[model samples]
Target: MDTDALSPLLSALRDAVLDGDARGAASATERALGQGVDPQRLVDGALIPAMDEAGRRFENGEFFVPELLVSARALKASQAIVTPLLAQRGGVVARGRVAIGTVKGDMHDIGKNLVVALLQGGGFDVVDLGTDVPPTRFVSAVTNDRVDIVGLSALLTTTMLQMKATLKAMETAGVRGSVKVIVGGAPVTQRFADEIGADGYADNAAAALALARRLMASGA
Candidate 1:
């Protein structure tokens, strides 16, 4: 396919994702494949950028959870078409492995759920630990699964303190350096994340996905 033919398909993918059209996104992905376009071209060129714009809007207050979920679902739809192809072709490394859960003492899950969806959509393998996950479980997951990132969610001021404890546990188990720790939720802040010695903090799901990508790239 000529570059000119590829341009409209890319635009279609971007607009479909911006509009949160999952069916449209999938159709665009399949069509791109039929056109002999590189799968990575669709993923890196269109899908990631669309989600990045969606995240920017979410952070800026122009989009909310509903819009973010819509875009995430759209990305997942497109990813469904691309993943197997990459696997069969070989030499395609997984983006990363992520272990995510609400911290011990937190029962809220809305934000964590969104983060999980977006992380998978971004091509990361995710293990959802449910709400109120304990530090011991996190340590086991890291050591057993060889997790690349540990994402913590805490909705209450009280539960937020567990983030520090969780980090301590990782250090105690000697797994702290093997994985990057990222924290989020309504009560989480960059200052708190720093105090807890976390590797990153995101204000929302899109930001969380971006943070995961960065940490993966940097081997954090």
Candidate 2:
């Protein structure tokens, strides 16, 4: 493997993802692989860092939903090419597992989807339960899927009540203590999270990712 060729390919992959160019990302990923770049290196060195930078930009108000959505698309494209290879080689190890969804009665998923992408990029295995998810589903994900964290999203003030309901369900099912619960959405507040006995709250996707990592570090 020529070090000179490898560095350029990796840089191309990173640039494509940061620019939200999905096709360019995939093409660059494939070229890098063909040139004998390590799959793990692609994931750790290019994909993860690019997403981290994207998250940073979003946190700093330099990017918004449109930018994040496209960057996530590019990351997914690159991951589609490299993830399977990494899996076969046992080179990928999840930092943790998270189950996330929009609480019942809420059809909104834009924020939830952004959190999922950022969490995945941050090396956690995320289970996206989509929109309008009920308490039972959250319970089942905890009891059966064994996720380390459960994220509840509610874009509407009305649907926010479902976060508390979900927490109650977890307690009743004997899974509440086993996982950390985080809440967020346009209408959610840290006070609401505390009132509902949640483990944490985040205002946006970047903060959510940081909250998750902190939770994992503290053994939640």
**Top TM-score model:** 2
lDDT of every model, 2 decimals: 0.85, 0.86
Model 2: which residue pairs collide? none
Instruction: Report how far off residue 136 is in candidate 2 (Å).
Output: 0.4
- Tens-digit lDDT track for model 2 on 2-59? 7676778888998999899999999999998887898768876787678778878988
lDDT of 1 by residue, 35-144 (tens): 89987687667876887788789889999989988887887788777765653442235689999999998876656866776677678888999999999999999999
- Cα deviation of 29 in candidate 2 (Å)? 18
TM-score, every prediction: 0.60, 0.61
Superposition TM-score, candidate 1 onto the true structure? 0.60
